[model samples]
Target: MKKYRAVVIDGKKLIRRGIAVMTLAVVAALGVLDIKIAAPKINVMPDSIGQSAVAESVPVIGAVSGTAEKLKSSAIAVVKKVVSFVLTFDPFDLHTAVAEELPLIKAVGYGYLARTANQSIAAYNPQNVDTGGGTAEPATPGTGQYPITEVDSGQGKALGKEKSKILIRNETDFGINIDEMLSSPLKFDMKGEEPKVLIVHTHTTECYSPEGASVYSADKSDRSLNADENMTAVGKAVKRVFEKKGIKVIHDATVHDNPSFNGSYENSRKTVEKYKAKYPGIAVVLDLHRDAFIYDDGSKAKFVTEIDGKKTAQLMLVVGTNGGGLDHPNWRENMKLALKLQNHISKKYPSLMRGVNLRKERFNGHVALGSMIIEVGSSGNTLSEAVRGAELAAAEISDFLNTLK
Candidate 1:
């Protein structure tokens, strides 16, 4: 009997060990398989941080000694740091790790210049990428396969090569700016009784700005701050909104102070997951965020609305375009929703938007069909304006979800 017991124990240990290996292997696989990490944009645009979401021939970071050595000295060192930042599987704290290594981003300046010079040389070489003719125009709205309003014809010099570098740097340095970059891109009208959809107010940008905790109002502690951590508050707010509607909501608003980048999303993703586990019936998941586009003069973008004149915030729809396994369809469906919302707000409230942006990237939108992101205002914008915008957007969202079938 004792021998049998010992054997059982040994078998259990092996199983546990195997589980550990498999778990790690899966994470690495996800990383290689392009497990998308939606980097927060400074201007409300959701950037794609890890193009590598799944495992591939690429060596597991810090796996072999030689690989570690190579990473310790390669340009990919930044890549590894970013991966570590997104994965959060490390001895180093994500924020502190990135903060401590701000130099890495600054160093990229030289690389950028060198690359720009090279590109210039290539352009002159005549065999390179064709800058030929005038720029192509965007397809008319509702003209595409989808039934949505048209995006502005504004294209071209706005997305120049140099601007691309700045954008890349911004994505690496900060995740995504919830307020400024992504103009509201949701469409739906919930004028009356409808199922209550929830928008989780998360901490994308660090709460404490240079001024104070105005736009920085969050509840982050020693523990990580994501939308989940503040589910209590989220639940309460959602409950408050849905009290009369006979609807219960799962809110994931963790007012933790962090930069509105990947960290915020990371924290929020876990929180939403936990909430979903608790309440499986959840249909819509809205990530309510503010932006951070401070002008050189310190003023933020503002829009005059029926409520009052406030800093204008941009809203974006971050949908998972990855149709790969685990990736969801109808990701573009959110685009339709976003456009409707943006148009409604524009008609009812002018200057409340820079415009809605369509990011090819996904910011966890694949989790559900009702998933979408909304950015209010930027760092230069007042917290009061942002709060007002949040409330307004909430109203619009609530109204819109009521219409969702």
Candidate 2:
């Protein structure tokens, strides 16, 4: 009977030893796989029993190493199978199961489930997803697809003669007497060879649509840091026109909207002030920008018109007033200048001008006597179109400036 009891005890020891070896193998396999798991605490046999089992079972070091290698290979295979199962598991089905099983937990519902469902559904439906970052539908071919209301240069003339020459999209209560403002001529008493015009871009990174591309990227940003690709290029085009007409012009290609979109006006104000301090003769400070218009259907508007047989983006003169409670006394003068330029450009190209947008924000217009914001083209217009528009406007603008003296 004692011999029978010893055999049973030995069998129990062997089982304990096998359990320890299996546990060790699993822990090592998890480490190899780099998977994190909270292993349950197991009550192992005493050290003496474990040592005896190891000594009797794994007598040679070589045998013990060989057994360990086999266990490791088996553990690796088991881990790979578990990983594969987890990857293939349907998260939506699991969520549904949980919801059905625990109806009482409805008060603390899984809000993320709806988003997950949308993502899953979107993954299978490529047509519904705009993976190319462009508009859902391709844009209509050709420029000037959208019709613009041409300024009736004769309608408002009977009401207010000069004001009639330019349509004012007024957003302020400040009354503008166009005739009174135009009566006082814009004078730039130029000293020899000094810059009379200063062209700068507050939103310097504003860009146009891709050239010759019918489809516009909806998710792609309309801003770029590249000077050649952004508003700086437009400013350069305007400067070139001015210089060709023997007008000294300064183009401050400082980037004001980068790093942060906020405080762009403030940063640009500093830039204008710095240049103004350096060049006191700078009479006209033109803040150039590209306009952005999005329709309810997610299509961008292109304010484009053909001029001299070339495609040109339309120009808008934005004149800001002190209606926003800022001290801008020279706003009337700025309006007068904008009117003169708009009227002159309209005479040449009836549909070139998008009219003058009068707003409440000062937009640093009070910095100089002839400060105004000129929006050239929009996100839907190409850079070449915008450049052509700027050049045309600048030519007429230079002619007007030449008459100033």
> Which candidate number would show the highest TM-score if scored against the true structure?
2
Q: Write the residue-wise lDDT of candidate 1 on 1-405 in tens digits.
A: 010000113565455445545555554654455333333333321333331332123434322223333433332344545545444333134544442233222222333311111111112424322111111111111111221111211111233442211111111112334333235443333333433355575443222122222322111121224323222322344345554444445554464334332234446666777776765556677765443322222222232233454432333333333322223466555555555555455444433444444333345565555676554444333344445555555555555555453
Q: Where in model 1 is the C-alpha error above 4 Å? A: 1-196, 202-247, 255-264, 294-320, 323-328
The TM-score between candidate 1 and the true structure equals 0.43
- Worst 10 contiguous positions by lDDT, candidate 1: 132-141
Q: How close is every model to the real structure, measured as TM-score?
A: 0.43, 0.60
- Across 1-405, the per-residue lDDT of candidate 2 in tens digits comes to 010000113565455446545654665755577543333344333466675576456443222333545444545545544433443332235564354333222212454111010112222333432111111112222233332221222223323544346577786798877667667676444445678788888778888777775556444566788888989999988988999988998999998876655456777888888988998888789999886654423446677776678888888888877765667887888898888877777677666777687876677888888888888887778899889988888999888787765
Lowest lDDT 10-residue stretch of candidate 2? 112-121
